[model samples]
Target: MRVRELLNYFKPYGFETPDWMIVEEYGLRPDQIIRMDLNTSPYLPQKWLNSLGSRISKLRFNRYPDTTYRELVGEISRYTNVKPEKIIPTNGADEAIDVIVKALIDCGNEAIISSPTYDYFRVSVELQGGRVVSIPRKKNFADNVEGILSSINDKTRLIFLCSPNNPTGNTTSYDDVLNILDKASDVAVVVDEAYYEYCGETFIELTETYDNLIIVRTLSKAFGLAGARVGYIVASKGTIKMLNKTRPPNSLSLASIELAKIALRDYETVSRNVRKIVKERERVKELLSTLPRIYAYPSKANFILFELLEGDAKTLHKKLMEKGIVIRHIELNWVQRYLRVTISLPEHNDRFLKILEKILKEKT
Candidate 1:
């Protein structure tokens, strides 16, 4: 295929309508639209924002950030309880994925993915000219450990797993992860814990035991830093060294680094917001289950995956969009009826539920 044709095959992240388009077409102001598609925190880290605002005046925009990122690494070390040498920060978990794939995946190598999870991992691997073998998850959205292991071969170089997984909001079993690690000892197994703050389960501890294990996490979700784009990788020091060679120098801006440090300093606030979001998640999930013909999957993370039993997901998504409420419509072969919604503030959640119920009732 030509370069343009190959580019057409590339799948980028998320579906979005520009703010200006929404305003012009939907006749809704940007603030009126409730964004439930992107799994971002509705609540801001007010204290961190306040601190960041005060510190922004002190930042030197003209000078570049320290490429070594020692100070930021120290903060992350304290936060993650991992040594600084074992951590390499990236622009976001997305960049961490790209950098790791770039470092470890060469042309013609294969990477195995647990399907119906995040799409970016496959994109990263393919960009490196690596082939992707996707093993579908079980009916319950759990990893198919046997299928994944059987597919591993001399060409397999990486395996990607997401915990409290995107869209599904379910976690991979710890034993399943351990089994994959033991069997595929030569290939790198990257576990993405981007929603860790919501679930509070981690495989970071296993990194000490397994050299091939890599953990990528982001502050974009729970830390309320999506726009700032801060994330990091946790692996053995040797693995970190190899990834560092491919990681771009000064990928994170000075403002982002400083804001992340401030956010880390006030970890208590992040935890408090997490608790609120988790509580709201349960409340929202319960309410969603009460809706007729809708099944809301049990979620450990801050978002919930909902399956519509009767209606078309695309039609429902369009209806929600017309009403200025946006949630993701799952497009996988096995889950065409599924839609994922991020847990927002209580009022916003109530609004979404009300609007959604009305839409379903109207269809009936």
Candidate 2:
């Protein structure tokens, strides 16, 4: 289909939102709802909140930020151990994806992505009037590297790899990434490391070796800065220069940049929080496993994806909602009967486990 024709039928990606109507029907306040759907950090301690709020007043909200975002780039460069010239600060990882798509994709061009992964990659590509070539992941939710590599042709301009993939909560293998990089030498390989802090494995160093590699990172996940919307792209100097052309000027707010700087400076604190989440994730996974009907998949990310063996996923989702809890019931064409819940504070985790166990038991 032509780009203009496709625009008429285009469906913008809709982000998940809590069912406020359900919340009202249950007679519960918004604050009372235990949010385990979004893969964001649990409530921050007061000290962390204070730290994030400390310098907001100093930032000139009335004035435009440095369009180049030089200071933020320097901080990100220091944090990621990449040179400053190779980094481009973005509003969020989503924007980073959009910028990459904008720079590389033209009408009728193509971008390859693995199925049951983040939808934004597909959206970004399609928005640029580029076609999305989706390759299904392996049975275990690993990227079908061979399929992806084979699908690449002259028209393929971008390949998005979301490590520690969302909803599925799995990482792409290092060797598999290298294999693709070796094969698709001409195509831009975009490695999204949004969840890198959860799992220490990374393809960042590969960027130095392969000029076609673009590594996208964000403070959203482990750093608990989702609202701040700060992410950066790491690529070769030439690639960064090209992406900068399409990146929106002053896309990041001064407040976000300041918060990101604070986040990078307080790496120790973020690390501590990440460790706690990882520990909690294991505990939650074990607890979920005890439920005979739910098969929780192994995950390195902050969330768990599981299949409902007996009960209807939508029913379970509704039950959880009535009980003032929220988690994602994943609905996609290639996958079914799956749900995901973010790992949260121990008490919150315990509540969800207790409620879920009760619901599944009653179903039996």
Measured by TM-score, the strongest candidate is 1
Runs of candidate 1 with Cα error greater than 4 angstroms are 1-5
Candidate 2: stretches off by over 4 Å:
1-5, 18-22, 48-54
TM-score of each: 0.96, 0.95
Q: Give the true-structure RMSD of model 2.
A: 2.2
Q: lDDT per prediction?
A: 0.91, 0.88
Q: Model 1, range 1-364, lDDT digits (tens) per residue?
A: 3475556677665556666776788788888898888899986767777888999999999999999899999999999999999999899999999999999899899999998889999888887888999998888888899999999999999999999898789998899999999999999999999999999999999999999999999999999899999999999999998888999988899999999999888889899999999999999999999998899999999899999999788898888888889888887646589899999999999999999999999773
Output the lDDT of residue 162, model 2: 91
The residue-by-residue lDDT of candidate 2 on 125-158, one tens digit each, is: 9888999999988888889998998899989999
Worst 10 residues of 2 by lDDT: 43-52
lDDT of 1 at 203: 98
| Global Cα lDDT for candidate 2 | 0.88
